[model samples]
Target: MKDLFDYCDFGDLKLNSRIVRTGLWESQREKSGNMTPDIYNRYENIAASGVGLIITELYSLYPRDTFSKYSNTIHYTQFVREARDLTDLVHVYDVPIFAQLGFVQYNKKTQQNMKIEDVTIDDIRKIQTDMIIAAQKFDFGGFDGIQLGLGNYYFLSRFINPNFNTRDDKYGGNTFNRLRIVLEMIKVIKDNTKLHINCRLNAFDGTTNGMTLTETIEIAKLLEKYGADFLQITLPRSPQFFTRENKEENPLIEATEQIIDNVNIPVILGGGANSQNQINEMLNSTNIDFISMQRPFVKDPSFLVDWQIKGNGESFCKTCNNCYWKKTATCHLRSCNP
Candidate 1:
């Protein structure tokens, strides 16, 4: 069986290993939402540490979507120029970078910050067109690929989310209907750019009556049909579906298996996969294609190279949720949940 260090190619980009520096909200950016040299240095450090792919913490596709007073938002020409510098830096270490696109109208942390009004058919079409335009801009700017945060439901998630989406319209009814927006959005972008597009699906929404496994698999199927290069599967800590209780109990492995069983495309699972033993098992399963964890990266971004070389199983992280809390507290540094 191949270990986590094995390479996996997704489109034109070739990963030297399957170990992705998962999208942990590092808060390493400046308060103005620009990449500080420290964040750049962190990327450099991770690349030098030998991570196969460094998917960034969420970067807003539009400046208005930036909720973090200090996160690195990529909705500006200035940000685009600086992003090229960061990617160039990553390439120097022979590591690839995938900038995660973000938008969160159903943002639990800052619902008050966002305004949500259901759209008419005409309005929906225009919004979709705007999203396509935005994607084109980001692709032309020279990023390798775009990771759609659809699973977390910036807008599409809300539409699919039972708690937030209450519309009777075609865009917000059943699970299949809710996914249409993201599918169309991805399709339009794929139609225009050769750049790889990855779609994230919520394995569990973390709510009481939120998203279920069946619906989640359906979402992944839609992504596959749309020609998504990868399916980024994650658990959403929602108020109605996935909950804090089960998120701790279930972990990502079991959830990843069910998702991988449904989709033929490569499936990427992240969130609390803090050890190499689990990562190796994921690779050996022949079901899961990638083991992506965020918090462990926050604890020690270079831990991947260490584990890859050592081939040990114990977790390097202290199980700290600081990366999540720091974002809530508006702190640039991780909360250090240990």
Candidate 2:
């Protein structure tokens, strides 16, 4: 029988549990984008807390991108060295960590926030090249994988959405063409590095003429066929979209199940779950073997430890969205201890 705490095989990597910790913001870092003591300590606590897989907070691809101020950036000189140390520390606890890399806007020096249709082929090549370089740095830092931010209204998400990408060029017409930009980048990243490519994709964007579940299923299949080792199912605005009103039959869960049916690789049901019994129930009820949580871990990095010990446990997170709105790593509520 499937269990949440069971040791499992997530692709080639073995995990301690089915709970994947997906991170978002990083407000604890130094102003210069350097890792601080609090950042390392938070990670150590999370690593030691028995999460199956740890996806680190966003490492913005561009310093000027929308969420870069609230995220980690590899442009700093100490990035490789500090990342190596951080990966080493997580390795001590036998937990595999993947760096979350993404950017919200594509801005060149002269052009500020270029639209998807406005970007030229040279601009596309530049984005691909930048991503490849970032993957190499992650390889040097000893990361096990790289989670590409292709979901939650990120620049790439917008680039692929039919509503936003109205370009008449080769990079923007059919489903494959719209996805070509990411597929091409993934190919190069795969060829150059050993990093496992995990793409965070939206199940449906709820926008008129935007991405629907059917199109998303096609995208998942293409990603698996091309190179992605794993996928995370999300929405355009996951945090806001996931409400506590109906936990029994979440549309995301159903959407995720549909996505899982189409793809051969592991697909994570990202966000909205906050309890162990609920997680175990979902695991037993569906074919979803992996589930990812973000805000709960922010509320308490070591919360899983307590969940493991107590057998039946629930997170203290209020789902207030402060972590999302405030852009901080630590919870804004009361002090948290596991």
- Looking at candidate 1, what is the lDDT of residue 69? 48
User: Once model 1 is optimally superposed onto the true structure by TM-score, how far is the C-alpha of residue 258 displaced, in angstroms?
Assistant: 2.4
**In lDDT terms, which candidate is top?**
2
- In model 2, residue pairs whose N, Cα or C atoms come closer than 3 Å (at least 3 residues apart or on different chains), thus clashing, are none
Candidate 1, residues 1-338, lDDT tens digits: the string is 87777776755678888777656454666666667777777788888876777787776544555453434565555866787788888889888777776666422333443433445566567667766776676676666677777766566666667777666767766776767777888877888986688776677776776887777787778778877888777766622222234455445567778888887777777654556776676578656767676656666666666676777745445543444655621223444423
What 10-residue stretch in candidate 1 is worst by lDDT? 328-337
Residue 301, model 1: Cα distance from true site in angstroms: 2.1
Which is the leading candidate under TM-score? 2
Give the whole-model CA lDDT for all candidates, comma-separated. 0.67, 0.91
List the candidate 2 regions with Cα displacement exceeding 4 Å: 245-248, 335-338
TM-score of each: 0.83, 0.97
The whole-model C-alpha lDDT of candidate 1 against the native structure comes to 0.67
- What is the per-residue lDDT of model 2 for residues 1-338, given as tens digits with 9 covering 90 to 100? 88788999999999999999999999988998789999899999999998999999999999889888999989989989999999999999889999999998998888889999889999999999999999999999999999999999899999989989998999988889999999999999999999999999988888889999999999999999999999999888888866565455567889999999988899999988888888999999998999999999989999999999988899988888889999999888885444
